[model samples]
Target: MTARVPHPPIEPPGTRVRFPDPVLAPSHGVLAMGCDFTPGTLLRAYRSGIFPWPHGDEEDEGGSPLVLWFSPEPRCIFPLEQEPHWSRSLRRTLRIHPYEVTVDQDFAGVMHMCGETRKDATWIIPELERGYRELHRLGWAHSVEVWDTSTGERELVGGIYGVAVGGAFAGESMFHTRTDTSKIAFATLVTKLRAAGYVLFDVQVENPHLASLGCVEIPRREYLGRLDDALEVTPGPLL
Candidate 1:
């Protein structure tokens, strides 16, 4: 028998210098697993068509939950001209909702609200919060806030937060404490982003909640192509 040659061990998925391409990532859109949620890392991930989401401990081999990076196959996005579906009741609520909409007022506050867990279950773990907050300080993260003023006091009731690069706004999370509150906040966000000449609004993945709001999915290859176009648009301040 000839002398055997040794092969190199594979590095953990996504632990390499760059993210895995769509063809290399898993079907569930998980490009790679295991990474620290540093602000710089997060920025690089987003620009590379990936974002970090916390995995349950079950995904781990008995230690702390792991952070997994994803680039979903059918990536979700909001068309530049897409208008959210407005139910009759939502339209009425919009007319009577005594709330003020603001941008980047309290980005950390928005992230905290989104991180709030019900029955102690959530993916926005502590580390993720700190990471995004740092990104906010760097002007890469932003929030759209909704404040309730019907009671003569400004109470934060709804908001959405995301990272924006060039003309692509990658929505990370959103939260609401009142009916239609977050919905209206999202609408206002759309208006502002449109006026700002945003060419893409990436939502990461599609769900019923997002589909109702006009989020649609396209092949990852197509999304990457669009991402390239969006990133070529003149950079502008999103906050």
Candidate 2:
């Protein structure tokens, strides 16, 4: 038997990478599986309108769980032209201005908190965590941290984290330890993205919480078209 040869690493920050057409993906939305999480690979995947959504503990060659690349039909995204829906209570929380919002301050802390605070999911495995951490170090991943400043000491109460490419941002997960803190963090992130001229805000999938914040689902084809346009833009750095 011939020995298996490793593939070359993906290159460049904004290079386009081809992926299986999402239209041909199965009902479960997995476009591919079992790839390493190098920064170039993640950037290539995102640039191709795909993202990893690994589940289970089955280790791959990198001691990480087998990764699943997904490009779901009816992809959920936040429209860059409008503000997120704000509830009366959330408006009140914003008016009070009780928390300090910072960007890229504590990405790993936010990620770990998000994993720990997920309602009924165990998707943020250790291997994925390391991958995103590396992305953060390389300026492709970012976190919006919400801090409780009422007690004179800054305490992290909530945050949101995600990957960025060109004018697009893909929000991975968010968590809150205090009331409306995560919402505050998300709103802060959106504000920053908009100010920086981001054209797309891909939230991956919609949940009740995301829908409440005004995310909308569009056909994968439309999403791909928009993603293509987004990648052509050169927005200011999100961090």
Candidate 3:
């Protein structure tokens, strides 16, 4: 892969600006940006197609200030018009699934589980958690939850969360305790997004898992163009 040089910060008039990929070095396939990830600052970053990902302590401060900014070369996205591959096994699981799906329920709990690390320590510190929770409260961020009656009402099996800007839904993280649970939640969310006229589902960076679900990459310049169009359309509720 060719190394990209990070570009100097472009202080544009609006609260949004794209961080040049060439100047921002990626670590473990991610990048870092933003001085303070407070709710206000983080919101501004997402609006501009920038997001914070937790990084190692060796490269960043111990907690709140440690996340990195990333702009992947081939941004993974699911187009609204295309049908993502839903395998026979996955379809069977969805049909026989005992889990019920909900939106924006237990948003904080989902975040807590996502931050937990059985092996390495977590980077979603107190400040980051609080900030995202605030975004949820303000209706700018949301969570898709999967629950099972056998596991009890409070037990959430799978879900995904992210901030929604205009027609774009920037997916942050997802977790699942049962097979195909997260996939079901994601497929349902996509169905809702498409029905509501959303044009873009920004997965940020691409991975093999996302590729299997039909996500493809576009150049940063082209991504910015779609983002501009997406931001002009109104968003639909996740529920």
In the range 1-239, model 3's lDDT, one tens digit per residue, is 11121122122234344455532444333554544655566666776677776644534443335666666565778777677667788778877888888877777877776666223436676767887877776666777778877845457778787877778889887777777777877877787788867888999888787776667887766776788898888755554
Model 1 pairs whose backbones collide: none
Candidate 2 regions exceeding 4 Å error are 1-18, 59-64, 119-121
Off by over 4 Å in 1: 1-17, 56-64, 82-85, 117-121
**What residue pairs are clashing in model 2?**
none
Per-residue CA lDDT of candidate 2, range 1-239, in tens? Answer: 11121112223354344668777886567998765677777888888788988776666777757778998888999888886677888788888877788888888899999988886447787878888887777677888889988899888899999988878999999999998899999888898999989999999888899999889999988998999999887777654
Over 89-154, each residue of candidate 1 has an lDDT whose tens digit, in order, gives 777887877789888888878888876723333777877788777677666777888998889988
2 or 3: which has the higher lDDT?
2
The model with the greatest TM-score is 2
Which portions of model 3 miss their true places by more than 4 Å? 1-35, 56-64, 117-121
Q: Which ten residues in a row have the lowest lDDT in candidate 1?
A: 1-10
Query: To one decimal, what is the Cα RMSD in angstroms of model 1 from the true structure?
Result: 11.1
Q: Please report, in order, the local distance difference test score of every candidate based on alpha carbons.
A: 0.75, 0.82, 0.69
